[model samples]
Target: MSAMLRKWVLWLLGLYFVGGSGAALAALPIEHWTQPDGARVYLVRNDTLPMLDVRIEVDGGSRRDPAALAGLAAATAMMLGRGVGPHGGQPALDENALVEAWADLGAQWAATATLDRLSITLRTLTRPDLLERAVALAARQLAAPAFDAAVWARERDRLIAAWREAQTQPDTLARRRYAQAVYRGHPYGVEATPDTWSAIDPAAMRAFYRRHARACDARITLVGAIGREQAEVIATRLLAGWAAHGCEPLPAVPEVAPLERSQDVRLPFPGAAQAHILVGRPGIARRDPDYLPLLLANHIFGGGGFTSRLMREIREQRGLTYGVFSHFLAGRHAGAFTVALQTKPDQADLAVELVRESLRRFTVEGPTDEEIAAAKASLINGFALRLDSNRKVLDQVAAVAWSDLPLDELDTWTARLAAIDRETLLRAWRRVIDPERLVTVVVGGQP
Candidate 1:
């Protein structure tokens, strides 16, 4: 094997053995500091590779968009990397020039919008000159997006087309309607329809960017072969010039009310060979005390792939569907627990009933001690793969910072997983999972 491939293999094997020991990996010594402009910064120094990864998460996403303009925050995030004219005396940089500059420095950058935050990520070689240049370019993009009129018009059209196309997909439609039914009048339920996209004017997007993407609400995480001093310098350069804004606090996410009864909705799709099934209800938030237990419980119930009860019962035993799985989303606020699967249209009803039964059984009896132990073993041992690289580590760091999770959570993850007993798992399941309250949406012909 080539040297690089051989090195990676050995590295993975080493992590696997570490996981097998049931020992938590030592946490990265995360250094926390605040930028002059009030951006929160978290850094971890790992000189194992000559690379740097930076992620900036602002407390603004779809949840913050005006109800009338559901896609505004998403559109704003999409426009951040496009181009920016001179602002506060800085020179202009068009989208192409900005991209070429990063290419010249052997770096890359991208942005994404989510339910709770908008994240902008950058990666580059850890050489001081390259890192500095990349950070400066990112800062400019974040601080002064041009929101060019022509570009906004084109992007608006593209977004509308994409939404229209998505409406034709059964799985997409099922998931969207499921969220709407579950959240019901909550901001989380608001989806971007064609009208939402069409209403997205450049002026509104620019205003939303300025209001929500300020340094005051930004959480920055950096992982690289750099020292504390260098990391601080990079962060300052990236955030110092942005003026802080006194934006209104984010609206509190209302508690998701339990379903009064099981609701089933079916939408017919012409010539659909399979039915898309979504079963779920409101779940816990990231900081919920039951989060860990729910996570462990989910693995045995459905999130563990073929090893899960749902998959075993529905697919392997009954042959109801090819795949079935469940997961808790754990967002900034109370999120969702979703079980998704697909089967022949004629078998849709049976599949739904089987899913409900699986959930009922799992919650009522919970997983056995052996099952819990096995689940914990699998989850703990597999986690090392998540921190196998600088980029992956950076992603974890960003998650912790943005979610306001404890700094040592990553270091203690395996130990925490190993510590959960069967009782704890059962208690979490009883408190969180409710099959009777699930809202089911199936898209296809009736069975």
Candidate 2:
């Protein structure tokens, strides 16, 4: 790649990692209901567009992965379109036929797994003919996926090769080492290796799907030109026969454990021109009480791009690296609070020291009143961008459902931020962050 293109890509990555947005639109009216089968639904009707987006959040993330088969949940989700079993009048359709079926309808369907949720989403026009068929096809995949052994073999080999290639990267190595130190003995730290992929067969994927993909435990979010009544029918259809009626709920998964002490690990990667450094520990969950205040505080800390303190100190002032950022990976379990950067191999120590010092000072003194005001203004003003499209709105609605937040969370977002002053932010920051216990991992030229 050319130097100019490399710089542009790095800039985009920096902006994405330093994440925050503003809101300038009117309040969104979110409608909520529960189906007879115990599935909860949230709807945001936007008749301005003819497109509909349906998202289903299931508790089939890596958290539910059997220790021996770390990638089963994800593998099952990835193979949803590989095939679907015969049901009602439709014959069994293989992977290619499934793809052609969706192509015929001019709609899209996909399932993806993350740390805490396995999401299945579809996009189709609001026309009755297309929408009805789209819902039926998605239901088939949900009710009875084929989990073909031949497909799994090919996918497993491809994934193993991809993972092995990624491990050779300095950034990937740094992230792995940091996760190990921060989330030791926690499912949140679980990563699928080549051996784990080898161990996960089609049977294991089927078992994982059956155990976790139940309608009773689902949060279905719909955003489109559809009313509550139409959405209800669509949601019920998509989740039809997801699980048997009288089955008992699965056992609750354990929460992520907090780090007992700080760890400093340096991984040797000779000839690495740019060193990667990560400092992190177990942070907050989605339902954290002080989530709003902490969100603003994180923006000022490192989440806000060039205007953030980390950028000003590490890159702008001393020029240690092109970028530095702090982010909270909040989810169902406590995700890590991470501050990361890349710099020259020789300057890794200085970069690490500066990041540590920034954390210490922020935890102690907190952000100033001016900083708080700036962060709120920046975030609130740009929040509307987050919901500019149907897909983005679906994402916000799905997150609200997954986190069990109030239906009016998006409407009252700016009001909540406006109410938070310096004292509230400072108190929340101090409670959430403790620099003394942060784990530091550096992957660079020297050990």
Candidate 3:
């Protein structure tokens, strides 16, 4: 080959590699559509991996269950993967079979409860045959749940036993009481009691399904090894048949107004070695205008790991607790903002004092310029690591759809962090995270 031709070829190859790497670095661009049945669909295609992960979330989660039937929504979600139609298998047996099939095909399926939604998730190799079968089973689970009577009894008994065991754990007991005290009369406060589980008869499950499990309220997200066209078809097949009915509106969770003093709830656990502490109040929702700014601010306050104020004050400086951290919940509706720590029972009072002081300082002065810059850099630099897998990317897409964030939100996140100045951080901190209303719960000691 001529020298000139060789040089041109090398330059072209270099450019191709660099450009291709850039395109891959840009995760998957989000695409959106409304299904013919009116459900929202969000799609992101990442063909780098030979797998697909899908998540379907329906709104009105536990909130749709009647106030009298507190655990109904969760119970109904549990019933789904147990069996659909004539399959009529127990939850564990059905789940075992499903897992076995997924293993046979190198795939997976599962379901879970979140504060505002119930999610059914599937992951599978992108081969046509395995993908087809996996999605078909997912559709059956969604649209044709059997909620058999015998299965309900066993699940109810299991859940009751779990609840009973949880009550014996000081941390669990404190959280239950804390949630009830903080979010009374709202679905947020409900726990899975034997009574609540008993309220979940097959009829109740059917009623909750009819009310809350609608394609109209569903949001479907697909990521990995698929284009927009393929994602749309898969989503349609999986979700289109859900009974098209709206659910009831969520019961109002009243704002946590300031109490004269922070309420201290104490529960004893005999033979306990440590005390578990939780402190904070009703935080802003995910869609709050201050969401990004507050998230950035929180990093400096406690969410930034070793660099945070809580760690410096509580763990590193005084050594009151092994670990201490703070975070806002950012749910579909307002959720709790919390600072949590576990320390020796004898040191509980000292740990609580330190956490309170750290919070007071953060709210008062906000973050310094150096702290702010480091937090932003930490968040931006670490952000790419979050989308490292197809399943993780699907989670981000589902969160965006559920929280009504913009499709281009992830792409713009780093730039947004860079744009946040010190003043912006203080403005968000002052508005959303109030110091006076923070509820304090400590379990295992008198303190």
Q: TM-score winner among the candidates?
A: 1
Model 3: CA > 4 A from native: 1-27, 87-104, 244-261
lDDT of 2 by residue, 209-309 (tens): 87788888899999888999899889888888675533458778777776778899998887788999999888899999888998999999999999999
Clashing pairs in 2: 22-382, 22-383, 22-384, 23-380, 23-382, 23-383, 23-384
Candidate 1's TM-score reads 0.93
Clash count list over all predictions: 0, 7, 0
- Residue ranges of candidate 2 with Cα displaced over 4 Å: 1-26, 245-247
| lDDT of each candidate versus the true structure | 0.82, 0.85, 0.75
Say which candidate scores most in lDDT.
Answer: 2
Instruction: Please write out the lDDT profile of model 3 over residues 1-447, one tens digit for every residue.
Output: 655335334432332222211322233468899987667888876665678888888764775567768788788878877766642242423555655656777777777767788888888888899888787777767767778798889988999999888777888877887787666556666776777778779998887777776777789888877888888788788875564555446446444443345677777788778898898777777888889899998899989899998888888888888888888887766677888889998888888777777777788988889898778767766776666567777888899999888887776666666777888889888887778666788889754
Which is better, 1 or 3, measured by TM-score?
Answer: 1
Pull out the clashing pairs in model 3.
none
Candidate 1 on 227-251: residue-level lDDT in tens?
A: 8888878777777546654545766
How does each model score on TM-score? Answer: 0.93, 0.93, 0.88
